[model samples]
Target: MENKKELRNWLNKMELAHPLVIAGPCSAETEEQVLNIAHQLKDTDATVLRAGIWKPRTRPGNFEGVGALGLKWLQRAKNETGMLITTEVASPTHVDLAQKHDVDIFWIGARTTVSPFIVQEIAEALRGTDKPVLIKNPVNPDLALWLGAVERFYEAGVSNLGVIHRGFSTYEKTRYRNNPEWQIPIDLQNRFPDLPLILDPSHIAGRRDIIFDLCQTALDLNYDGLMIETHNDPDNAWSDAAQQITPETLDQITVDLRIRKEEGDAVEFRNKLATLRTKIDVVDHKLLEILGKRMKISDEIGKLKKDNNVAILQTRRWNEILGKMILEGEEQNLSEEFVLRIYKAIHQESINHQKKVISN
Candidate 1:
C-alpha cells in the first residue's frame, strides 16, 4: 500500500496506443468463442483479453461459467492472439487454476470485492506471484470497502494493482444498470493518485448504446483504462447480452473517443480557467447563502406548525414543489434526474429541521 510507484509499474510496462484496453466476452462460452473474440480484438486498442471463467450469477439456473475449463480456452486464445488473458478469480482454487493455465492477469469482480474474506483468500492465494490484479468496486457505494480490498492485495505483496469503477447498485430506478456515483471513483483517485483506475462501461451502462459516451466521460476524467465487454456476436451472448458490443463496434468507439489532456501548460488557458472557476466560487457562495435563508424560513414554518398542532410533512405541498421545480428545471435545460436529486436533499434537510422543532 505504501509503495505507490510499484503498484503502477504494470501499467507502465504496457505499450498501448489509447490507454490500456481490456476487451473480451462476458463469459468464456467455448474455446472457439473465446479464440474468435481474442483474434478480433488482437489488432484493436485492446491489449488484454478478459473473460469470466467462474461467473458468479445473481440467480440459479443460469450459465454460471465454464469453470476451470474456460481457463484453458483463455490460455488457447492468448496463445493464438498473443494478447494477455485475464479472468475473474473469486476463490483460492480459481487463482490456482488460473495460474496453472498461464492466465496473465486476474480481476476481482464486484461480488467478490464486497467480501473481505473472499478477497483475503484470493490475495493469500496470489501471495508470491507478481500478476497484475484489477479489482472492481463493490456492489454498494462504500469507498472504504473498495480501498480495503486493494489494501488486502497490497498487504499480500501484490504490488501490480488497479481498480475498476463499474458503478454501484441502488434500489432507485435509474437509466443506467448501475448508478455511476462518479464522485466515489473521483475521490478514490484523489486518495491514490498513483493507482490506475479503469472504467467498466459495460456494467455501468448495461447496454451498448451508451458505452461510447461513458467511455468518453471516463477518459475525460483521466481514467487509466477501460474494461469493455466485446463479443463476436453480442446479440446471442449467453450472459449480459445487452451490454456486450461487437469487436468492430468497440474499435469504432475507441476511434471516436476524444481523450482530453489532464491539464494545459499555457498561461492564457490557465488564467481563463482560473477566472471562470472564481466566478463559479462566487455563485456557489451565493447559492449556500440562499439555502441557509430558505432553511431559516423552514424553521419558522416548523415552529408555526408545532404551535398549531399541524403535521410537518405536507405531502401535497411537497408534490407541488417537486413538479414545479422539475418543469422550471427542464426550461433551463436541466435534467429531471438532477433536479430531483437536488430538491430531495433540500426537502430532507427541511424535514430534519421540522423534526427537531416538533420534538422540542
Candidate 2:
C-alpha cells in the first residue's frame, strides 16, 4: 500500500494530459486490418492505439479475437507509427505476451472485471511493473466490486492505474445498449479523487450515430479522456460494426470536441460548493427525524393489527395509498412513477413490521 502511494505520487508528477484519446478497431482481425487502422489513426490526437487481441464472447463460435498472434500486429503498429499500443489482457498469459512484446498500456475489459479471482491473477502478473493499466467497471452496477478490483491492482504493486466507465447492463429498453448510470462513476470519483476516469463512449452509446453526444456528455462531467472504437472501414469490421467509426468521422469528432469545452469557473465554484453541502447535512438530519416519527407510527399500526388479528398486508389499503400519493406528488410536479415506487417500498416495510409484531 505504501509503495502504491509512492507510485501514484510519481505518476502525478508525470501528469499525463487530459482528453487523452484511445482509438483502434474493436478487434485486431488481421495483420493488415490492425496495421491499416493504426496508420490512419496515427495522424489523429489518439494517445494510444487499442485493439482486442482476445475477446471473451458471451457465446462460442463468435469472433473471439485473433488470440496471441494479434500481439505481433500491435507490436508492428507501435514500431512503425511510434504510437503507444494498448490491448485487453484477460489472463496472466495474455499479460505475459503483452509484456514480452513491449505493449505500452493494458486494459481489463468489463467481462473480466466481474471476477475478483481473474483480476487478482492479472494484478499479480502486473506486480512490480511500471506499465500503466486501465480497469473498466464491470458489466453490472457494482461500485464496491469495481473499487475492490482497483485496490487489488494497487495492492499487487501496480500504481499507475486508471478507471473506465463503460456503462452497465439494464433490463429496460432505451436508446443506450447500457444505461449510463453517471452517478456511480461520479461516486467513484469521490472515493478515488486522485485516479483518472476515462469514458468508453463506444460501449455506452452502442451506436456510432450517438457516440459524439455521449463523448460530449462525458467531457462535460470532467472525465479525463475517451476510449472510442475506430475502424478504417466500419462496414467491413469483424465485430461491433454498428459502433465503429471511420477515421474521417473520428477526426471530425475530435475537432468538434475541442470547440465544446466545459463552461467557465468550474473549479472555483466546486470549492465553494463543498462548503454549501453543510446545509444539506442539516436538512438530512431533519429528514431523518421525520422518518423516525413515521416509523413510530408504523409500529403503532403494527400493534393494532396484532391485537385485532388483522392481516399484515391490506392490498386495498396499499392500492389506495399509492393512488393517492401518485396524484398528490404529480400535482407537486413529481414523477408519478417515482411516487409509486417510494410509496410501495413504504407499504412493504409497514407490512414487514406488522408481521414481526404479530409473530412476537
Give candidate 1 regions above 4 Å deviation. 1-8, 12-14, 261-264, 267-360
Evaluate all candidate structures by whole-model CA lDDT and list the values in order. Answer: 0.87, 0.83
Which model scores highest in lDDT?
1
Local lDDT at 36 for model 1: 90
lDDT of 1: 0.87
The digit string of per-residue lDDT tens for model 2 on 1-360 reads 343344345445545335778899999999999999989988887858999999999899899998889999999999998778899999999999999998988899999999999999999999977777899999999999999999999888787788899999988676888877777887887777677788998888888999998887677666778899999889878888989998889989988873233356885576345434533443565466556667778889889988988877778887888888888998999998888887777777777777777788
- Writing each residue's lDDT as its tens digit, candidate 1 over 1-360 gives 433355445556665444789999999999899989999999898999999988899999999998998888888888888898899999999888888999888899999999999999999999967888889999999999999999999889887888999999988677799988777887798799788889999999999999998887777666778999999999999999999999999999988987644355685565446545644554575478679889988999999999999999999999999999999999999999999999999999999998998899
Best by TM-score: 1
Which pairs, if any, clash in model 2? none
